[model samples]
Target chain A: MYIILFVKISDVGENTLIEIIQDLISSSESRPDFRRKENLILGIGDDAAVWKTESGLEISTTDTMVQGVHFSFAYSSWYDIGWRAMASNLSDIAAMGGAPLYALINIGLPIDTDVDNVKDLYKGILAVGDKYSVRIVGGDLVKSHIIFITIVIIGASSQNLMLRSEMKSGDVIAVTGSLGSSAAGLRVLSGALTNNSEMHKSIIDTHLRPTPRIIEGQILAENGIRAAMDISDGLVIDLNRLCNSSGVGAIIHTDKIPTDRRLKSDFSGEEILGWALSGGEDYELLFSGPESIVLSVIPMMPAGATIIGEVSGFNVGRVSVLDPENKPIKLNDKGWDHFKL
Target chain B: MYIILFVKISDVGENTLIEIIQDLISSSESRPDFRRKENLILGIGDDAAVWKTESGLEISTTDTMVQGVHFSFAYSSWYDIGWRAMASNLSDIAAMGGAPLYALINIGLPIDTDVDNVKDLYKGILAVGDKYSVRIVGGDLVKSHIIFITIVIIGASSQNLMLRSEMKSGDVIAVTGSLGSSAAGLRVLSGALTNNSEMHKSIIDTHLRPTPRIIEGQILAENGIRAAMDISDGLVIDLNRLCNSSGVGAIIHTDKIPTDRRLKSDFSGEEILGWALSGGEDYELLFSGPESIVLSVIPMMPAGATIIGEVSGFNVGRVSVLDPENKPIKLNDKGWDHFKL
Candidate 1:
């Protein structure tokens, strides 16, 4: 494939852009493992996409990423923007322990935006979506002052689906993988962290392309684990939501909270801890179940799954962090809120 | 519910605003006709909304409405905005001869936006959604420079579905309801139509709250009317698309074309004709099948159904309009193109 530099979207009208998208998607569907192609009764060039579904429960989630608000072209490419947007929605399906099946993408672009950029953006979205065998079935495109991508995914889950409100008082709270890498990666990309170490590059990659913990979520469901959620708006806030929904409280051990080793080495302890506690967009699985069951499940989970805390009856609906010396650490603020930010 | 007129979204924060939305939706769900409530395995507060589906084909479509570009709040109410957005997507499902089952709305709003306005917007959505027993199941919210609503709908169709590519030569082209009413309504709202009569009020209502031809489409599909499309763009352009997709052409008769009677009486013939031919957002179904079959099925359709033209083998992939004298009318352009517009 060759790049045609400087072809503005206005050069090709909406019809032509749609034709281009149709062409790209159709070609992609020609790949060997394109799963939904056979089940699709109607794909592109329809009023809507039609696909066959089995008798079961379906899970759905929609997410939107707006330019200047959720992302900026300055630090991220259109490819990154598309991939990250798809990943975020895929993570929601993961949080539900569902298998991603189909996606509908709505893209709003400025008239003068590059046509090549839009192609790359779809390629980026497809890159991540194809990894999970999620098919892009349908979408809409419109003109806007700001660019944004809204992805709606349809997934399927077993009747025994995981939910946030299923945690018990004696449940163990475990998180998959380390945290704060995305936050540190953001700092590196913004040049806030100027250190050009190899660790910084990995951290930057984490921010740019965080993997959705889909497999881990499905495994947890298969193992009879009930309560699960993806840590999106930072650990403290998301965990608070989990506890609140379950009518329970949490007691977290700071030492057991998985902090990125690279982040620990580069920043102060408080700074690293703050990033782990409050930095958003981590896309890691956080689940709670019985202590013995979770401990046994940990070894079977993806590497780096750590038991960080426990659901406690001491307080009905509050979360507290304990230092190594068993003193409760006070958190002035919970986590990042889009409006607060 | 009492109005809290001056409360801005920023005053409550995102979580609180979410709580308010959850409460609003839950209350709406409490109504007797809330058909999806019982079947919904999980709703709103979970990672994603879960629902039961049978073994069958599902239809899905996504549409986005951007502020200023799609509508002006100066003329359209928040309710109109929400209703129109959902109508646009519902029309897609209608085109596919599918029944609307669920809707997910992703809204991007400015922080300074009024809280009551957002509530009213959702109320508008639920108003329309409940009309067809479509439930508000899931969604995402984010901040944006200009507000936009992206609605994704999941619908279901029987094994036998209507499609644009199913048209054949010698088929009769028919449309549900009269055209140009929506364009006329827009003109009235924009002050382009100054004479405020009952006709104008009806036309304005048509524009603000166009209904999806769901029942009409189902009847067409049940009658084995193979080729179908919804007239979202003007008659000529959307018909051309149908013809192009089916590898056929059409000759629509000007005299037979169903222009809104009110529009025809109030405006110049040319202006009303232009709206019928090139103005958009009609939300009516245009379908084609064998002439005998279509004629037999006409009696079963809605009252306004009209036989406007016939699909032809000549010209294979173009659409033309014929005056009463059988002279071909020249089209400057087919219809609205979002980018070109």
Candidate 2:
């Protein structure tokens, strides 16, 4: 007689797969950090989950990371992929100057994927959620041809919102931290760079676990700064989007742009500037407001925020950079575009 | 020199794709039905969308449908796919006896997909949202190897929640509507049955566009029927789940199960019973309560809800069907399993 003893995911099916997820959910729920989510009425294992919210405006945003397009197992662990996925969505909440309270994740993976790896990915997600005090409320898992993670974060803010369309002419433009680290790290991961220095290691870490400037964004909103966004696409490209939304223009000074100084030792000045201008996924806060408000808020910034430009009205929907000699330079190269063939 | 003209999505890049999505977003936002969502403070633009919630427990649930797993392009129109995606998530809210208020969608599609089809898909989504008064608040779109749609719905309910773990022994088991219709529809779509009959057409439509028993669920909740869930995974499978959750057992009357009468003409009783017991995806609400309360609430049901059985305590985590002779019959087959090889 022949008998089947061992089990694969296919052998046990979706119910069993969900049972596995239930274990993870329970573990996370029992953690002291997660147990503090008093607003949660129900977590998982029901028709739907429930939570409570106070009387205030709530913020919500969603972001997704496709396996091949966003990360690869060859260069990133499942944990990094999961961590980065949460970070991307959290950054959007941070940009709104809100405190994240809940998160919903939707994951699609091939059936043959190792279940242990999937658990590790969820652990990575919970790690970030624990840090931000965001509860993992509920989500869905489906079979897919390619692996992807989609996260939606719900946050709350009682203060005045920082809208992209609120920037005005003469408002000072500033960024929370040095740029180009993520792009630099990508280059190294892609084999275009061979540097193994400590600085390069930090740059790589920056890409793998980019920090969302939630506190910085909150400071900006609380200090009367009216317009802000997290830098996901490169500076020039995202700034153009901000300008278009606000019906304004910008002129950024190259000398004042806060780029990683370590890049200058190994790369040309133009290359470093190019990365800062068009290399995306920095996950840093960019804000514009009245000069007085922005200047006053700078001292409170963690990374010593630098004023790199001013909102311009020379032409709506136009952006330019100023060189050391004060010559206006137009750059044609925008940041990453996934659909570009 | 070559001039680029008549651009496809791949030719234009992600930014242009976003522009196309923005047009769809604006059109949906401006719709008269959607305009009535008064709590929407900020919709679709900027970093995070904002909305207001009154003091109440909110229901949140997420569901995902992958192209080849939950649906197929060969059998379903983009409109059907979109409608079903929203329906699946809304059904969760219905099962919870809640009114859906806001939704977030995360879609993954190939870059070569036609833009018009994507717009049609959104229109289908909006159609359901309009009917259910669900606001399309925010979403994310990314390129993928295969298509998938994930929807997260946030709903509010001030009534007592219907929990699966709250059922009691001796409570009458009931369903909101007839079962096996969706399974019959799937058979027709799969070419296992001829589709010339009106009954078959209705069955096919049932498979494509399921109507959630929201009113029935609300009535159940209001009538003090504390235990309920949507019958997504067929009667026997879902009842087994309910029994396991409540730590009890049940015995359903086979003759009392309200299956489609039209199926009897083309299929055997066993086959029809098999579908009713194990074919899944009906999206009908199933509930259990004291016989007196259930009978009182039956007149208020929208689709003529039927009592089919009674909760029992024969053994925990077990469910059986009773024949006309009162002989207990064990059923082994569950419903659809996406990961089943």
Candidate 3:
């Protein structure tokens, strides 16, 4: 039998790896539609990337994803990994009511990884970046036994910022678009359920390429919505966090929680509600504001918003969910915690 | 036999981990001398941190260090690891002639790691930040099989920026402070050398806690020096990078290279020279400029400057070293490449 050998990163060395990455980035940056921002003084291949700043508030956030913990290649492609990573950071900026400007990506890969896989990852990152006009300014690459990606994104806000601590007890709690679908989609990927239907494909797409509500977040912030956060670690935990920060509590009407029609048809009522309430990674923006203001901004949200909860003054940090019959619903799980035993 | 139980990160969970980290940061931030910048609109405990910006150029860079690859706890304390990581990014900002303003630290720890070790790491990070007036604005903590730290620093610079591509022929190449001490120190820590004297302690400190030449870099840029980069991957390789970026060559006088006096007292002449030329992690600034401008800035550098080479027009991207007799010296190795086999 003929032997086959695959080139590893160790064979080409770090400098060559950097050159390869630069080449990949150059190709993406050279696209006809890829416009370079005038504020950027220098791009990659320097001691540090440089950019000019306008007089405004800047938002910065960082997120890290590890292999077998945050993601796995068994179902998720490298492209999906990159897209998801960028989307998470983009969602953070959106949650802060900011427009993403630049990003710095740091990746740690096993030396045995194929260089082509890295190119595919960069392509995925560029795809989402192009969608939002976010520029890839600089990044770091190193060798590790296990793969990981840490991304830091810098964005600009128009003075007004939506903060979690701004939530008032009288405010209405609402979320943009549907939830539970991404969690359900992840379940499908993890082999909990299998079907070749179009709905299944849609759910998988939701899990793999969730959209960041940037414009909707900005609209809410501009329309006088003072408090907002992305539902990444499920509504229960994140809402509790917002409540804790604001020294308030919340009450949710379970029946009013938004979920995809397909999700309701495919899963049991309890399962769908559980995923919607506690299964995280939806990337939908949850916000609180006065009833009138919240209603006024509903028309401006592209994904639409559904009011499901109300902030309360009693029992700070407590989130009580009510069923259709108005009885308190008991949930077994709170949300996703990376280090929770 | 006695059995003992230690606290693992999994026992405390991600949320508690965050609270612990916040407490640690709060303690450091509350120091009497720690003055918060007015531009920082919001610090931690938000979806994303917010900071107002002055109208100027911003420099951003990221660096990642793996556990076994970059450092070993046997020789490097958790505090040193944190300080060194920050210093690396600070050096990058310095190389761009920028003043560090904020840092975002991302760390990945094994599930079994002790919580106290992480506190030590943060303490180390805070110490460095305090020294340079760089604020820890935001960060992410994640669980991984292997430990790692990725730091992204954002700095503000005047209109002028020192770039690697700005070097030209006939420029005098100078470096800040002495080199080789860090490498020599590494050897001592690795057990290749044995020493317990005060000189050895100084060398070890040089290897562990390197001083980034931030002020020196700004002085050079203000004095009209254009091309500069930090010697991270050794003088030979870094010089070649500068040469290649500028499409020029360089010639170095080996005897002119600087080394710590204690290093020479402890190591052989050849060993000192070898480490000075090819040993990485010096964190010293290597710059090229007109002879007059270089000389004029030398007095302003806190660590002093030594002219060791000159940019040349011949043999583009090649770096040649000459001995006392002016004969060419051949190096067995170039420099450190993370993925080099």
Task: Quantify all predictions' global Cα lDDT against the true fold.
Answer: 0.76, 0.75, 0.79
| Runs off by more than 4 Å, candidate 3 | A1-54, B1-54
Error of 3 at B267 (Å): 1.3
CAPRI class of candidate 2: incorrect
RMSD from true fold, candidate 3: 15.2
Worst 10 residues of 2 chain B by lDDT: B41-50
Residue B279 in model 2: shift from native, Å? 1.0
**Looking at model 2 chain A, which ten-residue stretch has the lowest summed lDDT?**
A41-50
Please write out the lDDT profile of model 1 over residues B103-204, one tens digit for every residue.
777888775565556666766676676677665555666777689999988877765577777789888899888888899889889987577899998989
Candidate number of the best lDDT: 3
**What TM-score would each prediction reach against the true structure?**
0.84, 0.84, 0.85
Residue pair clashes in candidate 2: none
Residues A25-99 of candidate 1: C-alpha lDDT, one tens digit per residue: 344445444333244432332111224457655677878999998899889999899889999988888887788
List-wise, what DockQ does each model earn? 0.16, 0.14, 0.16
In angstroms, the error of model 2 at A169 is: 1.4
In CAPRI terms, model 3 is classed as incorrect
Which portion of correct inter-chain contacts appears in model 3?
A: 0.38
